[model samples]
Every structure is written in C-alpha cells, then in structure tokens.
Target chain A: MNLHHAPSSTPLVEMVDIEKHFGGIRAVNGVTLDLYPGEVVGVLGHNGAGKSCLMRILSGAMIPSKGQVRINGQDAQIHSPHDARDLGIETIYQTLALADHLDAPSNLFLGRELKTRFGSLDDGRMMREAVDVLKRLNPNFKNLSDPVSSLSGGQRQVIAIARAIYFDVKILIMDEPTAALGPSETAMVSKLIKQLRDDGIGILLVSHDMHDVFELCDRVVVMNKGKNVGSHRIEDVTKDDVLSLIIKGQLPDDWVPRSQETVQ
Target chain B: MAETDRSPPLVGWNLKLSASSFHKLSALFTLACLIIVFSFGNPAFFSINNGLTVLLQTAVIGLLGIGMTLVIITGGIDLSVGSVLALSGTVTGLCVKAGIPVAPSMAIGVCVGAACGLFNGFVITKMRITPFVATLGMMLIARGVALQLTGAAPISRLGEAFGVLGNGSLFRIIEKGANGFPKVVFPGIPYPVILLAIVAVAAAYLLNRRQIGRHIYATGSNEEAARLSGVAVDRTKMIAYTLSGALAGLSGNVLMSRLITAQPNEGVMYELDAIAAAVIGGASLMGGIGNISGTMIGAFIIGVLRNGLNMAGVSAFIQQILIGFIVILAVYIDQIRNRR
Candidate 1:
C-alpha cells in the first residue's frame, strides 16, 4: 500500500499503560498505543501475543485490569461496545460479529437501526444505504437481502467492513480484515483499507500476515508476550526488522520512533 | 492509494430462493393434502358445519400457537402453557361464580395469564436459568397450583355471559321458517373463532412490521452477536416467553367456556398441541423463523385431522399416535432443511 502520511496531526486515540489480567494470567501488560488521522497503523503480533487483548480494551469489549484509554486527547471510559461506538471507534472483528441468519442491512445496523416516520423498521432506507456502502467496497456484490450464512467468507468480510464504515468511524480497528479473502478479494480489501486511509480515517489493523502489514500500514506496532515492543515507520523498517521485533521482543538499537526522536 | 493487479469485481445478481421459504410452502402443501384426503374419506368433512366445527376446535390451540410461535422464534419454549391455561380459566370461573361481573372476570383471567408469563420471563432472564429448565419448573409449579386451586374438582355453573365467550356465536340471525315458527341460525362465527382472528391479526402485525420482531429474531439467531450489537437480549427473550403465557391464558379461557366448566386437567398435555401447531406452521425450534399465517394454517390442519379421524371412527388413542408422528415428521423436516 502507497500510504501518504500527513505529519504532525492530533492523536485520534491513545491507550496509556493498558494492563489486563484473566484470573492470575497476564494477557496484556503496559501496552500504550495511539493513532493519527490519515494513517493505517498495523498492530503486528503472532497468535496469542496479546494483540487481540489490547484491541479488546480499546473496543470496549473488555475493561483493562489497569490503565487509561483516551480518545481525542480526553479520558474515555469504554464500559461497552456502545461506549466505544459513541467515541467514534468501530471494531470489525476477525469473526465478523454478524448474525448468520440476518441479512446485510440488518447486520450493518444491528444495534442502531433506521426507523420510519411512524417508527417501523426503515428496512428500505437501511438497504439503500447498505447497498451504497457495499458498492463502494465491492460493487459486484448483489445478495443484499440474503443472510450472511449464504455468503462466502470474502463477502462476509466486506459486509463486516461495510458495517464499520457505515458509522462515522474515526478510529477503525480491523482484526485480520483479509483472513478469509481470496487473492482477488484480498486486493479489494487492500484497496479498501487504502481508501479509508485517504478519507482521513485513522485505522488500527491487527494482522499476523507480514504482506498485509507491509502493504497497508504507514506505521507498524509490534507486540510480543503481552507487551508493545516498538512502533516504526514502514519506510524506516524492513519486514525482517519487524519480524525480529515480533519474535525477540526487541527493536534494532539504531532505530528510534519519531515520538522518541523528540525526547532524545 | 495503491492500484490492485486484478480485474474489477464482477457484479452479478441472482434471486435464489431460501430453504426456509421452501419448508414453509411445503407446510401449506401438507395442509392442502390433509384437507383433500379427509374430504374424500368423509363426505361430512367438506360440509360448512364441519368446517366451522374444525375452525372452532382449532381456535384455542391456534391462540396458544400464536404465543408459541413468538417464543419459538426467540429460541425459547414455554412448557407451562397448558398449566397456565387451566389456572387462568379456573380463576375466571371462580370469579364469575362469586358474582363478579363477567367482563372484569374474563379480563382478570387474561391478566393472570400475562402475570404467569411475566413470572416465567423473570425466572428465565433474571435468574439466569435456561428457558427450557425455567419453564419446565414453572410447568410443574403451575400444574400443582392449578390442582390446588380446584382441589382436582371442576369449577362449574359459570355465569351465562362467561360461557358465551367460549360457547356463544357472533352475528346470529333469526327468521320465520316455512311453518311460521321462529328459526334461529347459529351465530355466524363462533366467539372463539372471531377472537382467534383478532389475536392472529395483532400477532401477525407485531411479528412482521415491528422493531421488537426483528430484535426477537436477532436474539434467537445468535444471542451473543445480538448482545454485542446492542440488542436488549434479556428484554426481547422475556417478551417472547411472556407473550406465550398470555396466549396460553386466552386458550384456557376459551376451553373453560366451551366445556362450561373449568377443570384442573382442562389443558392436560395441551402444550404438545400448541408446539406441534407452531412447528407444523413452519416455526423453527432452533428459532429465528416463523409466521402467524403459517401457524393458523397449521392449527387448522391439526384440528381437521382430529375431527376427521373421530368422524371416521378412528379411536382417540390412534388419533394421538398419528398427531405425535406428524409433529416428529415436521421437526425432522425442519432439521433437514436447516442442515442444507
């Protein structure tokens, strides 16, 4: 992905020293991360590397055992997904978070549905808007009224992405957005991520795929064993460099994050 | 933005008919076949008198099926419906016998049913009990209460007005016959049949056009997903079980009126009939699918089969066996359809 980053923008979101423990086990520890407008920041980690744990805290699906999450430079309490959405943070989960029996419009507006003047379900309006949003991502998609169960993995992912974008997403968190897509579908999703980045939306992409991280991200955040190793600009870091950070939990000695450059 | 090295997405449209639609249509076909076979077997089965008789018989079970449809659509079941029915009807009968006004007594009966539903909802939602277990407990509790309410005796000699609700007919006409004797035609529609129609219309409207309807379907389809999506999962589930209780109450009242007495055993095993009717109507036990029209048709099919079999001198025992087999078949077909 050829991502053009606009320098020195306000932080759209920041999680400071987030810590989470499930029973006696530490799932995430002292992980701090942030996003700025018009940037696709890849959150890279191997399986069970606290990648999802950290994102869950930001998504309001789980409360951190300790730490603070701030949106737009203000402290935010994300007690639930509703709270996260209210903060303009939308999470398109890896599993898609869709009811298989429900159609696209229903899933897109599952929690917040459009209503007619007299208060009936404004399905027609929801469908039209869903078609519009879906067309932008995958114009060839046609099964607007069919349930997600009838859809292929690629189509379901597109629907999930449509749901996040339908809302005014300021900080989009996509967990493995192209895990189920074919080569062509992956390209479509790769391009969609770029389009969202161009739209001035800050995205936190959680991916284990190196190609996805290198192609779609402007900046990369690596995590290993419940801790953030480091963040680096894609141009300044190689795939092997990020891989070493993911595997060894240490950054290259000469490399410095832009945030750290000012302090030193 | 990076350009992808692939052809543009191939946009195409195909209107594929869903499997659920096919199953529901198949239900209609079954009902048609039942009608044809019965008509050929018994000449009386095709008569208007028998038709009304079948419709009247269907009314109580049909009402119960309406509530069952809602509950089943939300992926819940109410096993206490039969017990609740008896209790509601007995309460109404006792009230009427005590010289309370008929209208208020009947209203109280319906309220009793709704209250039982609310209690079931409370147990299932607040107590965090599985709906099947909660309702199963309620079913036994309700049966004991019903038995205690009457000491296993029937509440008899209910008020004239109260009996009319179950036994009375609406829109009757009286005319002078050829012998100049006053001849009175049975009411144009049995009161229960008319009541069933009113309730069915209301239930249909709620299921098809309301926000609550969609929420119920969503909650039933995938509860965790619904909760994450911000649907009030608890409230939607409660409403379904509560509605089931209320409908069972209405059925009990109708049964009491028709029998001209409230017996503790009035609706013994009636839950099976209500559930069977809903299933035959195309409701999925797994939830997220059903329609009132289909349920109505389903109820009629059951009613006609029972009455037709009885008229043909098929013993009641044999009738029960046949109905049980049919219910099994319906559910099996539903499972097969869902598998595909």
Candidate 2:
C-alpha cells in the first residue's frame, strides 16, 4: 500500500485525524498536529480536556480508535508501550512507573537489561552507563546505586528521563514532568529539556505549567473538550490565548480558532 | 547521595549488613534454639541417627514447602497441593502396578502434578478466578479423583526397589549394641535426605540467580507494574503453580514409597503445614519476599517440635494443639518484626 510520505522538511512526528472514545465519552476527538525534529511542542488542556489521552496515544500506552501516526515520515502502528519504544518514542509517565525497591541502575535497565555473554545482567556496565547518563544530564547526581525509594521525587524523575535517553529514544513524551518537583529541580528539568532539543530529539511535553511551556516550547497546541482548538508558534501566542482556548473553547477574536477544531 | 559519601566505612558497612544479614541471622538463631531445646528435652535427639530420622521425615514436606514458598511469594496459595500429591502418587502407583519402570512412573507423577498446576494457573489467569477459590475447587477434584482411582482403598505392596526410596538406608550397618555400653558400626545417611538437600540448593540458586526467579518476585510484588514493564505475569504465575504442584507430586511419591502404600487420605491437611512452613520462613502471603534458607529453617523447626513432643510422651491430640499454637506464635512474631 502506498502511504503519504511527508516531504523531507516536514515535521519528524505527525498525528492526523486522531480520535478516541471511552464508551459514550469521547476522550480525544479528531485532532491533527505535527512536531519537527529538535522542537518541543507543549500541549495545553484542562483536566479531561484530552491532553493525556492524546499523549497516551502518542506514547503507545493507548491506541487511537481512528487516525494515523507517522514517525519520520513512516506510518507507525503502536499497539503497546513496547511498540512505541521500538518506534523511538519514550514516555516518562507522571507516576514514573519505577520499581521502588530497585536501585537507579536496575530501574533504568528494568525490562530491557544489558547482559553479558553468559546471559546474566552486566551490572558493572549498567551502573557505569547509568552514572554517565545521569552525570551528563545533571552533574550533581552521584548516587547511581541508591534505591529510587530513597531518592527525592526530582531524582526519581531524572532517573526516568535517563532511562528513556539511554534507550536511544528520538521522541520523548513527558506527562506533567515537573508537577511535583521543587523550583530548583524544575529549572534543572527545563534545562535538560533544552539540552535534549539541542541534540535534535523531538519532544511532546504535556504540562499544566504555563511558564514552563512559554519558556521551553517552540510551539503550542491547545485542546478543549476532546477537540483540537488551535496550534500556534510560540512567539505568536500568549499564555492567555492558550488558556482561553482550553477553558473557554474559543480563541480571542483577533486569534480566531482554527476551523479544524474537532478531531476526526 | 550524601548518605553514602560522608558515612563512615564502619557505619555504612553496618547499615548495608543490617538489612539483609539480620534476616539470615534471625533464622539461624531460631534454628539453633530449636536444636538446643530438642536435644535438652531428649538425649536421643542429639544422636546422628535421630538427626537422620528427622531429616528423612521432613524431606517430602520440606520439598513441598519449597514450591509453596514460590507460590506464596506471588501472593497465591495452593490448597490443592495435598490433593495433587494424592493424585500424583496414585498415578505413580498405578503406573508402577502396570509394570512401568520406576523412572517413568515418577516422571508421570510429576507431569500429572504439573498439569494440575497448569489448570490452576489457567483458571486464575484466563478465567479470572481468584487463586483461593480456584485452587480449592482443584483440591476437591484432585482428591475425588484420587479416591476414585484407588476404589476408595489404599494401594499397597510395591516393588522392593521402590521401598528402598522411603524405607531403606543408603548404607547398612552391622552392630552389636546395648543401651549403656554398645559398639555400633556407622551406616550412611538416607538417600532421601541427600536428595532433599540437593533440591533445596537447586531451588535457592534458581530463586536467587535466574531471570525467571526475578520475574516470579516481580509478578508477586506488583503484578500490574510487572506486566506493564513487559514481564509475562500470567506465564510467571503458571510456572509458579506448575512447579509447586510438580514438587508436591514428587514429595507424594516419596511419601508413598516410605509408607509402601498409596493412602488417599494420607496427605489431608498437608497443604496447611506447607503453607505454614512457608509463612514462618518469611515467605509473605502478600508476595515478593522469601528465601530457601528461611523455609528450610521453618521445616526444621516443625520437624524438631514434632520429635520433641513425641519424645516428651505428649498425647497425639495435644501435640496438634501445641503445633497450632506454635504456628500462630511464629506468625505473630514475624508480624511484629515486619512492623519494626
């Protein structure tokens, strides 16, 4: 079957006509958006506004009932989180999905562990890699062997991000990445996001923090009541505009909402 | 991060050692206390022959307990284990009676046990039956089948070679001895005890070193999380139950061989002992924590207590009451320790 191939200059990640329903409730209606390589796209929506559901679809945690996902111009069929990972999509869930009793290195290598020729896990290599990855992201981090339960919430979040990066993910989907972090840790995470973008990885950031979006994202998409409201370049839209679209389901008159508001 | 860097080497060592080492030490302490109490209560308990006797008696139950530990660790219980034991033993007996070789008969017994476990696994996983209810049903079915197979009578008179498994010693001793002054030649240990030790070691290694072992722990700890992380939760549970059943079957064969008869009612209430041994050994019913050494100690504790009660000439009925009290006390102590 011949599929539509986006031009070389097209965005690295694209969703078209995406729709999802949970019985009678439409969680995410028809929505379409594009994310370019080396760009962070902030998704803004109120609670139950379909931000998480959309992100879940992208992360392969949930499949859309209708629509298509394309990564690097190739059609991606992501039925499970592993499928999403195989397509170079990594998601750091808000819950973190961490094994509390396991140390950082073990948590980072939970399912897809590095093994020696003898087939046993290569702890030395895994620990070294975890240390290196953490150091690169936050030089202050030194406890690679500490169980995540002992770590602060920020540290656990960092380890989750490190896990995604170590797996060579090209697209990172973070759900409320800084929701529970202290101000300092939030700044640290913001810095890390910039560094990841500089390294040319695509990012879909779902957050309630408007400041974080304005500071880090290059573009922003607004969703309201299971429908895409509008997409705007970072410089072209204010936080007020995004907020209005999310809460009011309408953009300011001068900033007319896009006609393709309802997801297919 | 700072905790490890600035902590004194001795303090760090103590902290690290305390977490894992304390559990081992506690188990050993209990074991030592049992040995002392038993030997003090009965002079015969200190004899090597008595030790061999205790080990032989505990072997089948101990083996069943090992598998039960794994199942219990996964937050699941197998009430059907005793029934599976009877069923497998009957199958082995029937096969042997039909002129099947000893090895193949044993294999069939183990296979039958494994099949029963698979059924339990399937019912729980696919049919969404709770482990307790499903295994309870299985218990009745297995026990009924066992009774039906033997026509409600015990099957006896197995080959002498089979009898050697339970009744015969690895080495024979020729001795001329009286109670006060006696010269007794040494006899080798029972092969069953050696077999039990080997099985225990193998179980320890599997639970500690293998990926399959980790999967079992993970499935027990947080099954949804484990499944989300790509661990095959259903398959792991299936393996746990299957292994538990198969081991119970093996234990049954040993029990039958020792008794030289297939007693359908012999294993009644055995699942309770196996579960109690597992729990007392630190295999939490909540799942995600256990060790072979702990279970072995638990088995020894049970064995020694029984021996001590017998030597003390305690009534059989009172022995049961004491055992029940001991099980409760052990569990109560464990809960207190866990809280601390």
Candidate 3:
C-alpha cells in the first residue's frame, strides 16, 4: 500500500455509528467508518459478519436502524438506491445486480437511459457509449447485442464495473467484486481499482481475500458478529493480524491503540 | 480470448438470428406451413375472400393478443381479459341505452378496462399479491360484475354508426360478370382489421423504441435487480397491466360491433385464446421474451387454421383440441430453441 500522500481534504464519505436490526437479530451494530478521496478501504469479514450489511446501508439498499451518512461533511438522506445514485454513490452488488435478459447497452443504462429529441430510447448512442466503456475495461469484449446471461462471469463483472463508473461517480461500494473471479480477472480488477482511486474516487471494497486487502487497500477495517473489530493502516498490520481480527475480533497484545476518531 | 472461443463465430446471418430471434420466427414458419397444408386440403381456403375472412376473424383476438403479449413479457398473466372484454361491452351497451354518443361511449368502455387494470396493479404491487392469484380473482369478479350489470340479458340493435366499426369496409370494387353475375374485385378491408393493424404497429413501436419498454423487460427479467438499478418496477408493471386492460376493452368494442349486440355471457374462455396467441407468437409466460409482430402472426395462424378446418367440415371440438395441441407445440419448440 502506498502511504506517501496524506488526506489534506475533507473525507469523501462519513458513515457514522450505523446500526441495523432484523427482528431480534442485530445484523449490524453501531459502527462508524470514514473514507477519504482517492483511497481504497478494504472491509474484511466472514459470512454474516455485518460488513455487507454496513456497506448496504451506505449503498442505500437498507435503512439503518440508527445512524446517518455524511458525504463531503454534509448529511445525506439515502432512503433508496435512487437517492444514493443521485448523490454519485454507486454499488456493484455481489450478484452484480444485472437484468440477465437485456443486452449490453440496455444493462449499462438500465434505469437512467439516454433519450432522443423525440423521447424515444437513444439505443444507438447508448450502444456506442457502452462499447467504449466496456472496451476501456476489457478491450477484447465484443458481443454487444447478446443478452448478459450469455456472457462469461468476467465479462459480466466488467459490465457491473462499467455501470458503476459510467457516470460521474464520487464513491463506489463493491461487495465481493473478486470473490468469483479467477487469477487473471482478479489482477484486472485490482488494476481497475487502483485506476479509479487514482481518479479521485473513494471506494469501499468488501472482500475476504487477505492478499487483495494487503496489496490494494491503503487502510483495512474488519468486522465480526455485526461489530467493528478494528481499523488499521495496511502498512502497520500483517496479513495474519488482520486475519485474527476477522476471525477472533482481536488485536495484537503489544500494539498501541490509536484514538477511534483519529484512526483514519 | 477464452470467452470469445466459447461463443459461436460472429459472422453470417446465423449469428444475427440468435436463439431468441429464431424462436420468434419459428411461429411464422409454422404459420406458412399451415397455410400451405390448408390450401392443399381445400382449394377455397386459398381464395382472397378466405384471406379477408381470416383477417376479420383475427381482429378481436389479435387485439387481445397484443395486450397479452405485453403483460406476458412482463412475467404476468391477466386471466380476466375475457371477462373484462364482456364487461367493457356491457358497459358500452348501457351507455348506448342511456343515449350516449357512439365515440364517447366506446372511449368510456376502454377507460373502464384501464381502471380495472390499474386496480389490479395496485393490489399486486402495494398489497403484495402474486399476479396469478390476483388476476384469477379479477377473472371471477369481472365476470360476475358483467353478468349482474346486464341481468344476464343481451343488449342488441345498436345504432348504424356503431355497426360500421366492425362490419364496414373501404375501397370496395365490384364488377358485373357475364350473365349479370356480380364478381367481387376487392372486398377492401374491415374496420376492425384496420384497427388491429394500427394498434399492433403502435404497440410494436412502444416495445422496441421506448425507455418504458426496456424497463418493463428489465422488471420482468429480474425485479430485484431492476429495483436496485432505479427502475420503478411497480410503475412499469402498472403500465403493462393497464395497457392490457385497455386493449382488451377495445377488442370488446369490436366484438360488440360485429355481433350488433353485447351479451353478458359473451367472451367466455376468450382469455385462453388470447394467451394461446401470445404464447404461439413467442411470448413466454416466464417473461422478457416476446414481440408484437410474432403475436400478430400467431393470431393469423389461429384464424387461418379455424377457417380452413371449418371449410373442410372438421368438427368444432376437434378444432379446439388441435389449437390446444398447437399452443403446447409452439411453447415446446421455443423451449427447445432456447435450451440450445
């Protein structure tokens, strides 16, 4: 992880003390996290660890039981995915959230489609734009008219990523982006994440891959049993230390604790 | 590169047809085969009069199929269409009896259907009822309402202007043959047939060229994904169901005009025919796979088959069984095509 540049500006996003409950089960306890501009923060957790729930709250898929989100130091009311999208927050869900029957251009501009002066769908223009963005991510992508269900997993992943960055996105929430990808595809995604971060976009990367966290993320946050275990700069903690945090929600005995507010 | 290797080579018309397009066209191919076979079975089946008769016969069901195609493509089934058609006709009949003008009365009838569809949409989306159960309930309710409204009576002898909507033709040309026998040059086209053509073209335009159409497909393809993607899934479904209702109402008007009467018990089992046409045209009950042109052709197939069978003196019961078998065959072929 690169540590040369400091966060000199207001953090791009501040999710403060978010809590969510499903009936008697607490899916996410009070947890707070901050992301600065041009940084990738890896959220590490096992299944049902509440990391996905926390990210979903920020993505506006679920309303937190108690908490608020601030974008650029301003509170935002994210009640639906539409609200999040308007705030330049995009999420690539673990399922990719793609309608399988539609073609590339249709999926790329699913809800927010471009229209001609006659108020009809501007399919030609959309096709061109989809192709351009898709080629940027994977140059070899071709079958532009085929239904997305016919595409390979890697290609579908590219479509999901393309959808997230196709517009003027300020923040991106990726839930297990590389969980289903192979070795070469994983490398491609890592490169894309770095590229987007370099473009000044704040990214919350939810993953279980320690190598991915160690290599790509500037900071790491771990959760266990719906509670935040710890937050650390990737350079300050070893992979095993982060793994222990994910599994047992513990920190090293000799490690000095940074104040919660100043950790970022 | 590996992905490219998995897909067929993107060269030639074969690739352009794809699996879905082929499935849609299969219906057209079947229609052609049926026409050829029927023409051979009965020479009169190949005449211009028979062709016109088939189009006239198809008008009501074609309109119903247009709406059915839209609803089915949205992954919904509207079982109340036949009942709604009867209801629309009876309502229009009551309006005519009350001395309402022809055009406004027709519009009111279509609107009534639209309102019922809107209510269905509201119940399914807001009240969280499955479309199947909701529409089945609507079927019973609409039929009962239609029967009760007219007291199980038939409204007959509507005005001359109303009769023109279903029976009138344009550009008729007849010449006196030898021995003073009248030979028909052209029968022109029935108003209902023309109406079906216009509605079908408009429907095709909406499905292929509009944003709402894409949203409808997306909603049917995957509702959760559409919601997450910012599609107003409920609104799309409402539009689909509403359109279905309006089209069914319009079909009712045409039917009433043709019979010169509106019977409370009319249009029983018509919904099944509409569904059959849509399915035979390539619309899947599972949703997100259908087209207007395919549906219209599918309607014509039914019309032609019935006319040809009648000319051959086949029993009505046998024709019914044949149509049911054809519907199953069409869906089976589509499934096989898609599985490839």
Q: How does each model score on lDDT?
A: 0.84, 0.80, 0.86
Model 1 chain B: worst 10 consecutive residues (lDDT sum): B1-10
Q: Can you give the TM-score per candidate against the true fold?
A: 0.90, 0.88, 0.94
- Per-residue alpha-carbon lDDT of candidate 1 for residues A193-260, written as tens digits (9 for 90 to 100): 89889998999999889888888888999899999888778876778789889988886677655445
Off by over 4 Å in 1: A1-10, A252-264, B1-17, B97-99, B179-182, B335-340
Which residue runs of candidate 2 sit more than 4 Å off their true CA positions? A1-7, A134-147, A256-264, B1-20, B168-184, B338-340
Give the C-alpha miss distance for residue B99 in model 2, angstroms: 2.0
Candidate 1, residues B1-340, lDDT tens digits: the string is: 0001111223362434456556667887988898899899989889877888898999999999999989988888888899999989888888888889888887888888888898999988899998789888888888888889889899887757778888888777778899999787654688899999999998887765577877887887888777767678888888888888888888898999898898888888888898999888878788777778878878887998899898889999999999999989988988887787
Highest-scoring model, TM-score: 3
Ten-residue region with minimum lDDT total, candidate 2 chain A: A255-264
Model 3, B41-85: lDDT tens digits are 989899888898999999999999999888888899998899889
Determine the TM-score of chain B of model 1: 0.92
- TM-score, model 1 to reference: 0.90
Best candidate according to DockQ:
3
- Candidate 1, residue A228: CA error in Å? 2.8
Question: Which window of 10 residues has the lowest lDDT sum in candidate 2 chain B?
Answer: B1-10
Clashing pairs in 2: A29-A263, A30-A263, A30-A264, A31-A263
Chain A TM-score relative to the true structure, per candidate = 0.91, 0.91, 0.93
Candidate number with greatest lDDT: 3
